[model samples]
Target: MAEYAEITYTVEDRIATITLNRPQARNGYTVRMSDELADAFGRADSDEEVRVVVFTGAGDHFCVGADLSQGGFDFDGEPDGPWQEPAGRCAKRIFLMNKPVIAALRGAAVGAGITITLSADYRLAATDARFGFVFTRRGIFPEGASAWFLPRLVGMGTALDWMISGRLFGAEEARAAGLVQRVYEPDELLGKAYELAREIAASTAPVSVAVTRQLLYRMSGLDSPLPVHELDSKLIAGLPAHADSVEGVVSFFEKRPPKFTLEVGKALPAYLPWLDS
Candidate 1:
């Protein structure tokens, strides 16, 4: 299985790095790479020592999307009913992970690559990075929540413009539109990403960071800050009823950092704050 010649994972200094190792194919993603990525992110999410994840492709290209040569382009597989389809299952772990994920883009992020970058908590691109959502050109719709995440990041007008036109854009344009949080030289992309991840990992408690990430994800879908805050208030109120919140508050007043217990299993609160009244 290791002879597939794609996707690798390693950890250093609390950062789990998942590299798309298919440079020969411009780091195109195949089913093997998808499974590897799911496993890597799953481990990172469960490992307390691993506080952050960095995702990037090996060689010059970040990822040029799926390798159609591999016959995995249709996102097909066994279906355990409609709710358990392969396409959704493939990218569900990426969206559901509580750990912060940073994508380091040093080259082209096209098609599926664009979807992966959009899924990340923060995208750090090289100054020369190229991005394109070419799904329209291929006669396919955007997959892996790009339809939702892209518009949320860049707003409806810009998102529809890119999706419809499939125009290629550069780093500065991405930054201006808030698609990328930061840009650096090609050589500095990984280092800058690591610096940011380390800064956050070292200063923030892991549990708190994860919970804050959950809150942010929850709030991102709201229509306005008011609904977001309303949802946040309810969620925070529920959290205080848990033991972790009590410890967090007591430790705050005692001038000591809080060490929270991780009890967040598959229980995610359903808070739809986007309904217009």
Candidate 2:
């Protein structure tokens, strides 16, 4: 129910679209913008009707890093209170969401623009999109846990090249390095994003997608497969009794789109190890 000024949120056909709305400023990054983004994502996460999220910006450029119009980044901090980096506020919220997120980027998606989308489930970039890990160039450290995420998305060597050098790269290079899922024409970007989101919304179970997203992000980092196997066994053992699981099987054999009824807000397994985390 929170109102947002820096972004806009709308849902259609079960997919929530969260758009950065400062087109006049090229969706420049600011603390207020980050706060709104986190709030909007939380709203989407809690809405049971929202099955997937399509994140994007409303302008020729997605985001042009931080707003330096005042000759420095627009930021806020309290010496007497706790604070977190701007980009991390959005990235972490998206990471915790029960639904999948697809980021559609075009034009300049440099600095915070690219970093903020690191935790998104899928990143679809426009042919003209440009990306950068320009923190070092700005004399700032990684803001969105990119140090941990970038290396995992690409390899350590590629991460080092992007993060350390702080150079802007094109969409094709980003796709080649696996930083983005795919590249499309600027005119086709959002269509592609929505297409993929619709496919997921129509075919996948909400609870299953939530569980799979969480398990993959959390367990993939463990030192051993033994623990993952233990958790996987537990997850699979309960599947037969889950309503969505039953529907999945029936629809698969019937060769039709599934009508999964499970909702992430209520149907997630109580035994999930990281439920509290």
Best by TM-score: 2
Best by lDDT: 2
Q: How do the predictions measure up, each by TM-score?
A: 0.80, 0.97
Model 1 over residues 1-277: C-alpha lDDT tens digits?
Answer: 3333477878899899988898989988666676667777788788777878998889999988878875546444664666332233435676777788999997888887778667688999999899998878888778767787888899999899889998899999999999999999999999999999988776565655666776677666667798767766786788756666677778889988666555434333445332221
lDDT of 2 by residue, 136-216 (tens): 898888888888888999999999999999999999999999999899999999999999999999988899899999999
Runs of candidate 2 exceeding 4 Å displacement: 77-80
lDDT of model 1, residue 237: 80
lDDT of each: 0.77, 0.92
Number of backbone-clashing residue pairs for each candidate, in the order shown: 0, 0
Model 2 root-mean-square deviation: 1.2
Candidate 1 positional error at 36, Å: 1.7
